[model samples]
Target: MKKLLYFEQDSSRIRPIVVALSKHFEVSVAGDLLELAATLRQKEPRILLFGLASLPGAFSIHILDRIKQIMLNLHEEKLASRSALSVVVMHGDDSRWQQICEPYIAALREIPFCDIYVIPAATNPDELAVSIINIKRANRHLRTARMSATAEVPIIGNSTKMRHVIEQIRTYADKHHPVLIVGETGTGKELAARALHFWGKRSHHHFVALNCATIPETLFESEMFGTERGAYTDASTRMGAIEQADNGTLFLDEIGSLSLASQPRLLRVLETGEYRRLGDPHPHSAQFRLVSASCINPIDLAAKNKFRSDLVYRIADLVIEIPPLRHRAEDIPLLAAHFCSHFSKDAFSLEQNALDKLCAYHWPGNVRELRSVIARACANNSTGRIFADDIQFLYQWKFEGNSQPEVSA
Candidate 1:
């Protein structure tokens, strides 16, 4: 079980929550700042939770400052690394308490590993336990993302075109201009967008993504711009993608599918960095880097009047075109090996004939289809080795411009 160090002055109030979390973590409770510092040195826990509600007067900047100092001391002593520590601040949902805690929480946000969770006053122990576990999971994911971002570029391919694509991503990652990623279906446009985001200056902030193709036209505005409480019948307060992506990257996938009527609304936000929530007369400003993807050429759509030319120019400040699988057949072997290792539990290998067959067929669905085929092949193989017969092609296609081959089941 993972270790957790929790600080709260009143033990009885948090006893039930601690018991509930025991099944998921080996939890240690600290009743004072001194005890908390002692536990940090001895426990070497990865997660630290501060129950600000249980502190005297329900909130104190001095306590938080001391906690931060303790954390800094741990790092200075080479005891806990920033990546190894995740901090969670918990408080009751009382409006007055929340208002008092807002600025302090904002200050804590500077610590990249810190998160805040608001607990309803009536929340049961089980609900609180679940929420804390989810926060821990999110912290783990963020740490992993940070590690990946700092390492080598995450895109996998050695083809000349792919290398050029990687170079483009690295070059434009730190730039504030909007980037438009163009590719065919399943050609990894989103992957390129992520690489751009993770490699950029905004990596420390959120990376919120929304698929324009999947949302209905009626909800596009509400999804892009947030909604205030009671915006409509049964509507609750919610932060939309734009607000959630503030100070970070906003990825709009299949941007060509965005309704024409909603184009100007988005264009205005891009131009002015300001937006108004649904049913709210107030305007809020957001600062985010725009990264959009489209399977279709926005230029072509603009020419046909299917898309707005001005919006196209705004989003295409920097464009990245991802080549289809067929155009980069040389990378099939590397990609195949990667997928094989990922899908198979034990060691697996592909025969030369199997490789030949995979490289010969034209991949209409690009890398996505190749991954599925590799997964299916791994499932079908019994000898831990894959042969041409073990590989299944879903669609019959001409190999090397010859007659169509047999479709495998």
Candidate 2:
């Protein structure tokens, strides 16, 4: 169960709510900074709730610094648990609490808090319990994305290659430089882009995405650079993906598919962090971290005149390569088990023969193919064990080197 360390000025008013939440959370009460420090020293709760209506009489900058220091110390010592613990403040009314925390709100917000939101004044116990549970789960997912990269990102693989991928994500999550994610189709390139955005400083802002492959070449200007009222025949004032993603991240997928015409706009933003909306000559400023993905090596595309070399160099300050599933076949069983547990409504397990069959076939489509196989078995077979006969490889395609060969089962 997740734990909560709560601090309140008057213990009497919040005591009842505490008792009700004790059933769901391991709850501990702290009346003052001294007690709060004692509690922090003794235990590492997943969430810390500052449930006070007003600031404590003993509040001071020194005390505040100490609290942050202790939390940081705990984080370093428990690297695995760092992503799980969160600090949040809850209150029913904002007026008093706002006044109380206005000075320190900026400093607290500067801390990597999972969230800061409103709540009932210790009144609705049931609703708060559910909310707490939901918040805990959501934070855990984000934390998983940050710490394990692929493990918690819902990507479901634990190979040595995958661990390095996760490490790269954590490394680039904080920087402002553009990132290029290179991988084969179905290699979860977009998923890694999301991890970079959400686990980074830009997470609190918007995450705008544009898939160049799906977008028409004619609409690149309007879709990426924004437009103003009367900019076109019927265009109203609008912000494009770059403007919308200001102060956040803009992920461009299949970036190698971008024509030379659209590459200028992308290169302009990376070079100057500036762009003008269509019809409106007034250049609007947009500051965003750029993350681009492609199935092919973008530089190679540039060399072939399919992409601009200058643009390719600008977008690829850090390149992350996602290995194909066939290379990391060791993760197949774990990935298969993860999918079965997720898609199966009933209790389920895969037989040894079934597992062998899954591991034997080459997954040209990677984890995505594995998920489909498991999902199909769960839908067609009984709730019990699924044998080799029950598991089927519907697709007759497999990869051998760069060429795909057809094989009869």
Candidate 3:
């Protein structure tokens, strides 16, 4: 188990935090600064917690100077390198404590430590845990030279268009910018979004997805901003998807369908990192990365005033456009084989005739249509191997005049 060494003058407050963190870590308690420092040297704990009062007696410049000297001297010690150390300072009731701690805190900040958090005496343990974890993760990421996670695009195809898309995905996977995926309906927009999220820094947090088109217009506010108890006809206190996805990625799909009235509310949250729950006077906020996708051309919709231009700008920080299946014809065989294997109970191989038929067909419904066709063909075939006759009828489907000539079975 992970180790935590906590030093707090208030034994009452420490009990709750210790209980909560102990579920995931091995926790130890220290009542005073001297004991805490000795425990630190011996145990080398992962995290350290201290109350503002724990900074040794006598609140004078001399005392502050002594603390600074000790911290500076410790920075020179090679023994401090092994563990990820974080210090949390819980301010006491004395107003004078802040004045004396400010300069010392600034000096401590310059020293190389994982992180330093200042929280109210009344702060909840869950919020404390969230802040600690985020800082821990941020520190780990900064220390690494390359991405700690190897993000790979699972789809395979040799087509020029497919190759370009994969390259673009690789380029944007590790970036911090918001990503907007654009494509025709059923073009695997969600797949692209998940690939980016899993490859990015926020992968450890929840990947909460909300479909704007799927939600009703009346409930959009409640769904996005949780309601407070006694706020509305049937309101109950709850956390919204935004808070649930705090420090993680929130995937908003078909965002164009969101009402214009709801757009400004979303814009406010993105701008200020704050939002008032429905019927709640106080505003709560969280740090969440946004990833949105739309099937329609967002630019065209914004021009027509059907979609908010401001919202579009916020969500489209880094846009990725996915080509329709008809445009990336070479990918048809690859996608077909993937889906056939997905639908078959046992290992199944696609005949060359079926692949030729798939390439010849005009994919009106894009990737979704291909998946459906492959599923139907796999379920109907009694044999494990798929034959040309199984998928030959796809060539007879009506194609746009610009479509490539049909390849014969």
Candidate 4:
């Protein structure tokens, strides 16, 4: 059984709830900060449940700061990895409790891997226990999926915008609603889509991706709805992207390129999970989550009458806008170093001048273009170090309306 550590000023008040939870978890109670930190270090509980209602009225920012310090220290020391330590704040609906715990709740929310559960005052002990159990189950699944998917889909960046993007992905990954990702080309829209699939409840199911721009207008229906035997010349029974993504995720990349004629057909499937094969009369139902990406703004396309507004609303229940590389320029060095290490077998280092050059130029093609430049530089450099001279910008002349930067021989 997993260990659960609960902290409260008055533990006796929540004894019934603890007793109910004890059946599933090895429950430990802490009445003070010292005991809480000690148990966290020694027992290393999987879940930390903070009972905000039972905290004393004397709770101050000093105390909250101390708690935040403890968590930060533990995180820095690797004693509590983000995936290992799950912090849950539980409080009642009482207005007094809410007023008292509001700041503390906000503080905990800033901590990674922390979640807040607001329990109504009328909720019985058994119901609260069940809810906590379900929370534990979800945390376990998320932790497992995160650990497994980290290597496969590495989203590298520490800038504020990138952090916001990551947090949005985490917040909406487990939801069943359709998600629309809008950004410029080469902004890693497909990467964000993959992160959503790999980190969600559907991680075990297949993740099917289709590029709307690549499909021919004549073949759109057959590609999306599959084909039955004799549907066309030498056509055999085959599954479509919808059927392939059943119970999983369907990623339509560059959805803005979808033909206007094909828009209504796709919208019908989104409205009702029903699609028919080219030759088959009977309709088949597929229950899969939709994750669509487009370089052009869907709203703008709809306004111009090139795309359907209703379809846009249906696909964009949640929207994640990825900032272009130039917008998050601070992440350039990190991305450059990552690309250097990935493309070269031997150890490669970037000089200060090289990094300065990388950060100075405006990346028109975004991260993908940066990766290509890094690969070429790494391959051409005889020494293991990359310098400003070795760095080349393919579109230097196009910068700032055809004015080019000076190059050194």
User: Which candidate achieves the best TM-score against the true structure?
Assistant: 1
Q: Candidate 4, residues 230-307: lDDT per residue as tens digits?
A: 799988665678866656689999999999999999999999778887887766666789999999999999999999
TM-score on alpha carbons, each prediction = 0.67, 0.62, 0.66, 0.62
Best by lDDT: 1
Q: What is candidate 4's CA lDDT for residue 1? A: 88
Q: lDDT score, residue 111, model 1? A: 55
Ranking by lDDT: 1, 4, 2, 3
Assess each prediction's global lDDT (C-alpha) against the native. 0.79, 0.72, 0.70, 0.78
Task: Please give, for residues 183-272, the per-residue lDDT of candidate 1 as tens digits.
Answer: 999999988998888887677766778999998989987999867656899775566788667657899999999989989999999998
Candidate 4 colliding pairs: none
Candidate 3 has a TM-score of: 0.66
The true-structure Cα RMSD of candidate 2 reads 12.3
Q: What is the lDDT of residue 129 in candidate 3?
A: 58
Tens digit of per-residue lDDT, candidate 2, span 86-201: 56555444434444544454454455533433233434555456556655654554455345443235655789999899899999999988999998888889999988887777
Candidate 4 ranges beyond 4 A from true positions: 1-152, 397-409
Per-residue lDDT, model 2, residue 284, is 49
Residue 376, model 3, lDDT: 72
Question: Model 3: which residue pairs collide?
Answer: none
Clashes of 4: 0
